[model samples]
Target chain A: MADREWSTVDVEDIAALTAVYGGNPARWPADRRAAAVRALAMDGAAHELVVNEARLDALLSMVAEPEISAARVDSVVAGALARLDAVTAPAAAKAAPHKLDTFLPSPFDLVRTALSWLSVRAPQAGWLAGATVAGILVGVMTMPSATLSGAETTTAQAGTAVETAQADVTDMPSLLFTSYTVETHAR
Target chain B: MDESVQPQPRVGTASASAAAPYAGNPAGTLMGLGPEPGDDALLARIAQGDRQAFALLAARHAPKAMKLAQRVLGNAADADEVVQEAMLRVWTGAKNWIPDGRARFSTWLHRVVVNLCVDRRRRPAFAGLDGIPEPPDPTPSAVNVMARQQTAKLVSQALAELPERQRLAVTLCYYEERSAADAAQILSLSVSAVESLLARARRALRARLSGVVQDTGEV
Candidate 1:
């Protein structure tokens, strides 16, 4: 089978080709330039379209190219190099971690150290630990009783009471501190 | 501004030679050379952190990039900023630049410049005022200078009113003198699509600037 080439163009195609490539068919794509030339030669309307488009191209060409200063070029080059440096710096940094960063403690390690310190150095550490264990035991022991009591009361009311208690517990620090300050001042 | 309409120096010809002396001197060299390296070859070197190759590529393409950006952005400062940012991307992304063979490096750079200009236009910093700056004319006669400035202003106004894509197509094809295929690659559009945009843009510009265009006569 012989490959078909575009050897003919319609009015619409000619108009579009002129609009894009300008009035010169030579500037059009190689495959379509032959067809465009043929169309221009055969059709008067297509020729007229080319003439009209040429006027537009002429007006466009008259619009001068903006002048760029040597200073502007220098600035752009300098700025680009600076920006490239900035971008690559971070990337290079990420590729190789900082020496100081390696010496810094991880979050889990920090938590384990604090616990160990408290167990060794703080007199109140045993009391706090004992209180936490008792609280957990009480919470476990009272779960069934609380469930049984809530069966007699509305679950909604029980939930509201639990929320109130939680809020009071959250406010305890301020109350304790205030009373402590008042006692110290009175003394 | 009118003088800018004259042809500019080609990127890699005399300019490349002028920059050749600094090729190997790291402290003083702005760009490097490797036996008349093309855009692709320079880019390959740039990927390896070759400062000379980067400088050579910048020298080769920066003028066209600046002109394209200025046409779209309408301000020299903003255009310069866009080119700077775009070139920076070119440098940073050099390693990742996969040559598709369908589009040239220059075409890829054009797309970068166009995209940056569009993004700059949408920024609130440029809102409310006209983007066009009056061209500095060195003509002795005040009348001729004013006339050129007026014509340039009218054209800039008409161009500024175009949609982003239409403006990009016109900048690439008309101002940059790129072929339809090149413009298509720059705009990331099919050739037919670029043609349609050019058609609509021409119609709108003709409608807006017909009276000024007629009055200007030669322009």
Candidate 2:
């Protein structure tokens, strides 16, 4: 095999041959081929030869096969973007500066502001008068019912009267029993 | 090879170079389309809450990532999943993407995709070429269909048989046309290590493709 009048093969030759047989031979001029052959000869067994061949075929197949559909590429990118969007959504949401809703005053603050306005715009007596009226309204709404109170007092008095009547009856019975016993003993 | 060539943060060119739709202008590459700024800048803008910039970054790099994923996993569907996951990682990390100016953003992106692909390729479902999708056979057009299919099958089979490192090394060099040094950086291997790996891979590939590569004209 060594005797076959070897024109030195090199990595460049492999590359040129790769270009040539891969169906783009025009890219490798003879000089380029010669240079490649020289490189391949010098660099033989240095890289994965079979794998390179396979890769060359794959590359050729890629070129031979029409460019991958643009739609395919679009879909892939769109899909990736969507995924990224989903993954980053929380972080993005958090990173945004506080919104208008965040700046709105609380209920307490609103009430305080209203009181301040009333104090400054109205006469001091008028503001105090309004506060007193508000306080009276709250007190009236929370007041106990007069009917309920009267009913409770009546029930207590009735209970005491009933107990007094029962005590009188119990004393009469005891007094009668004692008098009968003493009179019988004397007879 | 210059030591002064600061590592330019070699980001993946994925979302930044999206290919334009066929009906559109010639302006876009596969992932490098639309309004997304370059990767490093987009990363900066994204950190600053720029949704448009983030979208652009995703558009530019996803295609290349998908393609690399497909090669590693041997199935388009799985590759798609891997790319999606890889981009999700990029989105999360963008806030910290302080550019060191040593490598391109695309290069960094390439590494990310490669790592994801490698991880996914190790799964049981990706065991062999059996799961890889083959091109649909067209009506026989005197195209030597059998021969081409056989050649393609042999090539893919041989590729599948290479050690993962060798396979990746060859892929970056021959398929992607990356320089050895670039491949080394992507694989995180030293240049000499890549060279050695390539040497072994090429030898193995030569043995496997001897008959096919020879007869098919210089493959």
Candidate 3:
């Protein structure tokens, strides 16, 4: 079957082709490129799209490719080598594990790792310490007074109840026993 | 090119016998390989921990990688960092690389560079000025250099304002001169989708830079 004729190519397809492939029809898909070229020649809107896209392409072309400096290349390659070494070193060490090392790390090992990390990252440790102190200070300052006041009030209430009990004992029991004894003697 | 003479890094012993073929160049050597080695072949050697092959691959591809990075990242230092990191990944992952024949090594590498650049752009650590470097002039004419710098600044600003996908499409298609098909692979988009992206990007760029760049039609 023959390829679709130029008259069948729509403006939207032409515009999209222009956008993706730039203003050049030769660079468009081989199947539709012939029809697109014909359409560009016939349709004013399609021509306008190509012209506008060409202007943008011109601006894009003005943006030149930056030169990669030799120093930069060296630096990047060095960094890559260093990274490769760093990655392989651990694997190598793991392959030839120490006789004393266990499959699971001991507490001492964990502590040593933590200490090493802290030594290497002292700033992070400082930040953590500062955060902990700040949290403690904030907690202390913001604590509600109701708990302390409630404890003090309970202590005072207990003391008053004890004194009241002592006063009642002193005022009542001896008189009741004396009255009983006098009644028995009169009988 | 015997198996006993190829240069190997001193760190790893897994592929020691495999590193004997290309021993002349060491890591970080930027000298040309004279003839281009097939990417697959170099990758095969790289999988064997051949540093010379890696060096050759870097020399072959670094300039293009840097160009793509610089365009996407818009800063020399950031571009360098992203490329370096991508290259590092390429190094560490080469042993596991299975060439499925679906994409070329360059395409895969381009994707790596693109992803890293995009991630860097999103990171808070992207503190450098987000603008393309000014074109260097050998003669150092003050007025011409200034005008070019201003134009680059405007273009960079316009590019920065674009949506991430659109910016990527423009960088791959226009700046890097990649075909729509290859760019789609790098962007993980369909060919038509890349076209649509480029169309929208060009429209946006045209609108943003209407009066800035003189459309001489000569370019």
Give the distance in Å from residue B132's predicted Cα in candidate 3 to where it truly belongs.
11
TM-score of 3: 0.63
Model 1, A43-158: lDDT tens digits are: 99999988877776766766777876655555566566556666653235436677997899997688567666777788489558656656655554443222223334455665
Q: A1-187, model 2: which lDDT tens digit per residue?
A: 1123335655544643452233232322344445444464456452344245545545335322212343455566667555654665535755676679889999768867777777778869558866865765565455332222222335555455444433433333333443433333333
Tell me the TM-score of model 1.
0.65
Off by over 4 Å in 1: A1-4, A10-12, A38-43, A69-71, A89-187, B1-22, B25-33, B126-145, B213-219
lDDT of 3 by residue, B1-219 (tens): 122123323212212222223355443232353333466677766776667667556655666787889888778888888887887777767766776766577788889999999888787863555443536666756767677666766777888899999999888877776777889899999887888888788778878887684533332
Best-to-worst order by DockQ is 1, 3, 2
Strongest candidate by DockQ: 1
After superposition, candidate 2 runs with Cα above 4 Å error? A1-68, A85-187, B1-36, B126-143, B213-219
Chain A TM-score of each model, in the order shown? 0.44, 0.21, 0.41
- Taking the tens digit of each residue's C-alpha lDDT, what string does model 3 give over A80-101? 6556675543234435666765
Collision count for each candidate, in order = 1, 72, 7
**Which candidate tops lDDT?**
1
RMSD of each: 13.7, 20.4, 15.1
Against the reference, the lDDT scores of all candidates come to 0.67, 0.57, 0.66
* Candidate 1 chain A minimal-lDDT segment of 10 residues: A143-152
Task: Kindly indicate the candidate among 2 and 3 with the higher TM-score.
Answer: 3
